[model samples]
Target: MHLPIELDRDRAEPLQNQLYEQLRGLIIARRLKSNSRLVATRFLAEKLGISRTTVLLAYERLISEGYLETRPAVGTFVCAVLPDLVPAPQINDNRVDDLPQTELRPPLFQSRMPVGEPVEPALIDFWGGPDFRIFPLKIWQRITQHVLECYGKGISRPPPSAGIDPLRGAIADWLAAQRGIIVDRDQIIIVAGAQQAYNIAARLFLQRGDRVVIETPGHAGASFLFESLGATQHPVPVDEHGLLVDALPDGSTSLAYVTPSHQNPIGGTLPLERREALIEWARGAGAYLIEDDCDGDFRYRGMGPPSLKSLDPYGLVLYTGTFSKTLGAGLRLGYMVVPQELVASTVAVKTLLDNGSPWLEQMVLAEFIASGEYDRHLRRVRKTYLERRDCLIAALRLHFGDVQLAGVDTGTHLTWLLPASLPSAPAVQEAARQRGIGVYTVSESEIGGRPATLYTENALLLGYSSLEERQIRDGIAGLAAALRDHRRAATG
Candidate 1:
């Protein structure tokens, strides 16, 4: 049988490591059947187009892991005495000493955040655009006022570490009803937003030098958070379909942070097959998967993919979400749901982070969501954003004449892949700035990522959720004119 092995030279993972990973995954997934003879290194390497030395190194490690064995004068075969493969027992206490398992190891500013009250910016900004127009301010105001009215000044006492009771309950219910993630309220920890959640997960699971994989051209805020904790960075490149799961290295890592729902700046969703493969990869490597669904709520594509948490059966996915995108960033409120295994450590570390998020906002949001006003609000915003997304597409097409755009299927921004006929992304961005229109390139839009010459150098990220149809049209028009002027100057 031809053993299934493939490698991508462009991947951030080393050739040997990628080879080691796929073989191990095949065994763990039971795709490479037990006692099956593997192909010889010389022949297999030639078949896969890799150096024979690379295959030998990968095989050596798998032998050490008991995934494969070589019988004298026979051939390499799956190990008869396979290591135990079962979910690790959950730790009942909050100690960092939990048994090894898929351990619960475990930033878009600029779409309209509030300043006391939200205001429209003077420049026609395309990034960080939040719909402040129909924010249901009256309901939010009433709920905030009611929380103070009922609780009096005594609401200042330290709230539960897990979160305010009603808020946690509301979030739990909302996840089940909308996202198909069912969990108890206690499993949720109210976070300041997604940023603090990343910090908390790092504190709980990441030891120094623990490898953390992040999507290339991913949210820089996430990469910075893990790096701050002294975790090593391993960046996996993303494509139009989403995170490339086959690139995950076969080694111990504390966590892998991915924006599967609408991959940060690129806006691609991982299909179910890749999601399942990723979960299996994590299971084999004994790492946790932090699934950040920052914009999963507003998917333009047909019936978006399910949350990784929803598909996780081995207790390997740490799901992080925020209201900053759906409601408003001013709320500064988000929540994370831990598998029952990691709840104790997660809450303990979260308490150390902030002692808990602000009490009043929790109470007010709890009331808003439970009373069903939050659902109504989402319905209003989703329709508006869908319309806004369509308008942006129409405007770009009209002005640029067959421009390439991405992330349109979800999230607030769409990446405009600059045509070869035009100048580079940075030049267009500068020209647009001169016209008082805000457009961001990969460097500004995504978290700290190594330059992907093809995507980052020639792409401009545009956010349209906060702009009106008229503004979207004018902004594209302004960019078109700026590009024309830039071309004229270059020629002269």
Candidate 2:
């Protein structure tokens, strides 16, 4: 009997494993009838152009699972009685499932962030990704080789609870040089990324029902993290000047998280005066200020403001920085500059959460920074992104006559406020998505519920870091056409 078996050699799954799964599937689906004789292992192997041993292994798995029975002399046959298979319990539209749910001490709220995936065939993905083609791969390979050669056994050495020393020093020096912030190496703790750093901060500071402040129309994932910790949100609205320091409540908060340098969702840079005000608020309230400087590196127009930590005198600021925007998200490396007072406690918490980030990346990054390749790479990418940003602006102008753009002078993306002529942000987003382009509204980026005001109702965030100039122009043009169609349909 010729079994309809198709194997993909290109796939990562082992050939034997694939064969076993396929045979089991066929039996479970009842395509392979009960008591039906299966082809001999040798014959099947010859027919499938695979080793006889591969076929034997597959057959053995099937027999062990009771999907097939091998007779002493008569040949292998499908089992007369198939083993019971139960469909897996599924989470329905409501989060609750048929399976028994576990009760926890404090009521928990599970949340997820909407991540953008860029498929190979995607039309025009504005999903925030680094152009790996521009990454310093040649230089990286050399540095990696040097690190490996210099420290053979050191690679396997258990990393410090804080981080590898050289990396911490490099990070400190880079912060001083680039971001105008100087700190001891002991204060910098390496994390998986900004998210992990946030997790550590949440654990260290927040208690049940504690109030933590976040910006209005801010990143949902950030706010949701605190929310899940049983903290009540004290949402302060964000304007062109970043987080409103005046709106912050007096003396009753644990932490206040802000993305001051190129604020997430809505790009706003807090001025020096406002930065000072925020510091004072934290100082007075006895609250820790969490400054997530994820996109601080990319500034187009002029020298951006000094980092919040740079302005810190009282040591209330916990400054966070990530390699995601600089190197790439795949690096999964970020660091937090904790207050000297909180250093020991935070590092102890980090040890419990995760021993340390991977050693190879730490070693390689240390070398990269020491060799000044990281700075060089940053300089190169900054120029490319500036050109791309300009192209996007020009394209939007060409398609829709001089549209209003915000956060243009800095960061990988700028917010475009839709004119009254165009449709709402969601309508435009959906229409553009159908055209194989992604134009995200602030609503799409929110992890928590939407804030009170609708500052970004008609605003769309366009990330230009990963896209080439041509791609940016084409994507804008497509979005323009999509918006026009939407407008016409609505009018009719």
Candidate 3:
């Protein structure tokens, strides 16, 4: 049978890749049905004007990736267990004809913001937001088992709407001792993660058309949530120190979201003076500050500054902390220390949002923190991550010579400013990907929205926490080679 297979031999992509992509598209589009037989390699080669070896290699790759099946004695075919295709539903012509056509109303929110597609399994994911390789999984497993063994009977049922009391108490005590926020255990409301905590805060405070302040290049999740809730978001610019507090509007704002500890995307730590200024701004405007401390536990270079919530005398800050960075994103455990005045309202909102987080995980995490194991684990991983960060910086300098590194004083990743002679950030990212190395640029949504040319055009983000020291060096060398090649081609 003739199939719609085409190859571009002149393209940069390999012949095998072209063939694999065409066949995969056919299968996904359902042009090639499940269990349908594919033409023999020789037949396909002749039909497509490609060599038989190329066809054979492509077929082998497809089979290995689970898109095709090969029978020893018979032939190759589309996988029998492939998902069934659903045809598009038909629209009613008569109903459409009878309806009066009018101008459609503009949507209250902008069209959905495009998210970065998941990294292909074959590629190294240097863009993964948080490090998972160094997670204390063994220790966590032991703690989880201990919790189940000791508290199994109590957790068999659903936890209270406010979450397990002991876990809340542990979180409260931890915050008071570490974050300097004095709050009753009753004010601590546990949620799955900061995402859920944000949702709860939105529900409690935001109304349609309410104005909210967000960093210009802020967390996409927070931006999307505010947009989804019909709130108008005003983008506030961020500088080397952190958010520009002076840029905030003077009037009332329903909510202000800031990543004070380690700002997302840029990794700037908000200075103590800036933190105080932010608090004053929030108080004067009578707005709530949603402090997203997603990476508060991984401060490396210097003594970390105290949390903004700790200095908040007016109970204006809704302090949110997550274990996603310190522990793992999969754990999905985080807590918010609500001010005494907002406790009842926050709990009511939490109750409405999925009742509460799972009891078992919360219990186990609480026990982990209580036993002091969490602190020890942080100390161990922090050292390793700090070393990796330094290795990445040193390798970049050795290869590229005097590269400007930003956000290196803290956090799991740092941004390198490419020289004008090199290719742009996106160009560098794509070139590295071709060599099986993952390097991110500021323009990519993975780092947030298209960063201004000043911030993104000449910058690349290298996340070294998850990669080994050797891998880090190799990846940098690969990137340097790719950049050199690009420059040569451009001049030629």
Candidate 4:
């Protein structure tokens, strides 16, 4: 009789091993009764379309393992009893209620970010990601080739948990010149991305029942991270000028995460006056601040205010930024400039978290920054993004009468408030999506619980960094048509 066995040629596992495991599992499950006669090797091989020798090897392993016995004159047969080491599997009735009732503890919170299969991209996706066309691939390729030649052995070895010297130094120098922040190279720790940096910071600073102040309608990623750590989150509202410093509650808070340079979703930059006030608040409360300058590298307007970290005097701000926005997110490269006091703990935590970021990426990025190629590239990309931004603004005006936009002066994304004539932001997003255009509602982007205010209700976010001028215009036109169709359908 042909055994109920299946084999795959494409899997990395050897065919003989797969066959052996299946046969052993079947025998242990008692699917093949004790002392059942087995098929001839030649017949089994012909039926399975594998070599006769492959079947023989599987049979030999089974026999050696006490799952099978071979009669000298006859074909192989199942053993009457399994070895002491290979106990027979206890067969169950396949009834759900009969299964043991064990304690099933679910996670405290569900992740807001999308998981599993990635959401399908729109025909003209406005989701914020780097424009691959503008990426300096040739320069990177040359640097990568050079690194491979020079540091072939380095690839085999693990890098320091804190990071390599060259990359840390390069980042320190760049921050000094660009953001006006003076930090030591030793204080910088390379991390997988901004998310990982946030994780490291949370681990270092937060504990159960600790209080965290998060910007409402802010970054979902940060909100989720803080909450997952069992920290009690106190959400502060944001306005046209970013987080409301005057509205900050008077109390003790362990940590606060802010995107000051270009406030996410709403697109407001924290002004210098408020920045000073925020620093003072942190000092009074003795809370640490995490500055996530995720897209600070690309600024259209000339020189926004100095970073919150640059203005910080108490060394309470842990400044974090990522090359994902400028380079590519797939690289998963980011850095955190730690304070003098926290450097040791940061390094320890980083070492505990997967040893360290990869070596080759850090090396290539160091070369790119030190060689001044990174600066040159940013200048070119900034100019291109400005043109795209302008193109999107014009298209919006042309399609819909003069629209109100925010956070347009900086960052890759901008926010739009739906007009009185148009449907709600979520409705608009759905209409645009149906027409193969991607747009996001503000609530969709924010994490911590929504406050009573309707800041997120009528607002939509549009990311134009990845789209070209033509695509932006086309996308807006399509969006307009979709909205019109939605209105028509509602009226009918």
Candidate 5:
């Protein structure tokens, strides 16, 4: 049988490394069962349209990594004993040791949730979004009050479609310093939020019957938006490292929407290798890539990878970012950095779509960034979220041994693969719900297209940004108890 493997000749990553990663992912995910026979290198190479030497090198790497074993004169097969699924947490080369997972008192800003109170939810829901409790209410209020005192007149008049000059310039400066992107303010179009930013992008690049590439189990909102625009979507599967660039459609693709920096639902950060490959593919195919960096600012892994837009020299990337992940989603503020050619078109589209975002908020945000309070706020929240994430992971390990997780060491949320002893992800979700706790299956969350079976069948998405350490720990314990009750009921 032909293995489900594809290679991209245009990618900068070596074919051998590409093949090895795919095979390794499959093996780790258990798609290739223990002792499952692999086809001969010659046959596999021929099937994949690559040289036999490439296949041999990939196989050798897998063997050395303990994923496969070759029986002399017989055939190679998946190893009966695979490598440890729960390897030690990765420490970036720049860091000496992992951050302590201990829970510290939250910053003073996080002392109050929305409505100016610390009321806890009855269900203990871990709904994904910004933690409103951590919002810099005092600073934001001071800025808002100041902006109103100064620019209150502009609020009554219609704001510029592309955004106010101060905010745009401030955003440009912020991107240059934080994300290594040096685009002019004129190329930046502020919108209601990521939703509107995506809508603007979909309108510009997509037409009826146009082909759009989307990550499977990606942000459902993006898929729905493209579909509503009458663009036919092509689903590309994502592994732990984010979108499988090799699996991207070859040609006739008008646009490809990606969440390279902390993908929604799955939580994997796209590595530099695949980021380069994606850029190459977009350039060669003459298509546009939308890089959604919504959660890019909340990386726990020592100043994570650079934005994909930073690596794109071809003007093919449309970088979208939002404050919803940091500030409250209720604020509804987001921006998109477009190529020079599309700036006018995007501005026109923004003009037509609500004529721009709120003026007062934009003014306040501009001052917030210019004064460097935004950076300080991010540092505070990042530390808090990191502590919560670690607490959640530790809770899972405490309740369920050897917890297999994805998209860890970064992002506000992570994906957990339920052990075989537990029920399906949906079933687990139901059990958790019955116990007045919130957990989500891949499908129940904002998944874009159909996810791989490994994710859909067993993985549950958990968001830790909104939860405190105590809440995270309690939620996991409650979930574990719910699963136990569910299993007992099923057996009976």
Candidate 6:
């Protein structure tokens, strides 16, 4: 069979290395199917004008790595049992009946606020969190490989319901030194991510028909999870400081979800006074506060704000954090620092949820943090993200002229309050999409509660961390042109 293979003989790298890299890329990207047959070495070499020996060597390396295999007489084929090439699981129709009858009934679809529209491929994605380019890939790769080698034996065994002990220990030490919260490792429950952590928290805390206080225009994931679990959501307004403690509904609020370090969507950091007041209110109301510190690692300007858990003398807070934002979302490693009284119930719920997170990732992350690589990595990315944030602010000001911005003091992204004369946030977002630039509105996120005019009309959320400086400038330029064209058409 003819193969789409190209070789650069003039390049400094060996032809074999190039062949291996290309093949690896195809396999990783899932372009090459499992058990697919390959062209003979002779035919491949002839096609690429390379020596047959080079092609043979590349095939041999791939075979050794379990990415390819050869049958003595059947010829060469991609490995059907490649570690990373598992077939997609077929959905079982019978599983639908396994859920309870009440849950089987379709939920009443109560429409809530709109979320940020997804960025199209043709558009620059500046709406997601974190700068992927600045993630410590090299360091993380080393740690991952090292952990696999050193902890392979342990990881191969079934992980405990509580999670990897060393990882929980590492997290405990991290919290003590970084956030000033002292707790036993047993109190920590490792989960897939913050959303899963919220699920567990809701399961443990919320009863049906219970009232839950959520930050207005907060992280959509938490709000949705609470509602899914049958908690009647009470929207608490957030101003320049943070969630309005006075705005919380009177009576028993089972759970209060907040992003106190850097409020999601708006990026307002709750001050110490407000933090104290909120905690006091929680104590009086007998409520549980779920503090999501998803982007707390990238505080750009001030001294680190104290986490809500740090100030909780009565054990009213459940702290949720994830490496997805700091490292990458692919890691799927996060933990919930539960109150001592609730730890047992939380762990039980975690066990029933998914057993526990993958053992290797937790071990590697533990070593990464304990060896101080994690802190160093955070420092590097924090500086890079801060610079990118500044560049985005500069670009917006240069193009749009005197834009009002918020949430830039901390977190990976900030909100730009669009001038009334230009266009609405959603309209500008749609216009930007036509010009291949991604922008967002609060309604596009995991927001609950009734639609307020302020959320839909004024604010455009721009995540600057993910894009390169030139990409940021170019994207904004594209958006400016789109807006101009829009205005021209409107006037005409």
Q: Best by TM-score, which number?
A: 4
Looking at model 2, residue 190 earns an lDDT score of 94
lDDT of each: 0.83, 0.84, 0.81, 0.87, 0.84, 0.83
TM-score of 1: 0.74
Write one digit per residue (lDDT tens) for candidate 5, span 214-282. Answer: 887777777777877778888888888899998988776889999988877688888889999999999
Ranking 5 against 6 by TM-score, winner: 6
Question: Per-residue lDDT tens digits of candidate 1, residues 242-323?
Answer: 8899888888888999988898777788899999999999999899999999688887668787889999999989999899
TM-score of each: 0.74, 0.80, 0.76, 0.82, 0.74, 0.76
What lDDT tens digits, residue by residue, belong to model 4 across residues 1-492?
657898999999999999999998888778888889999889889999999999999999999989999998987999988887776576578866665554244545655562311279899988867899999999999999988898768888899999999999999999999999899999999999999999998998899899998887788888888877788888888886699998787889899999999887688889999999999999999899999995788778779988989899899999999988898889999999989999999999999988998999999999899999999999998999989999989999999878999888888988887778889888898899899998877655545555425566678888899998999999999999999899899999
- Which pairs, if any, clash in model 4? none
Clashes counted in candidate 6 amount to 8
Tell me the spans in candidate 3 whose CA falls farther than 4 Å from its real position. Answer: 1-117, 121-124, 128-131, 444-453
Residue 328 of model 6, lDDT score: 83
Q: For candidate 4, what is the TM-score?
A: 0.82
lDDT of candidate 6 at residue 26, scale 0 to 100: 74
Shift in Å, residue 200, candidate 2: 1.2
Candidate 5 deviant stretches above 4 angstroms: 1-122, 445-452
For model 4, the run of ten residues with the poorest summed lDDT: 109-118
Candidate 3 clash pair list: none
The model with the greatest lDDT is: 4
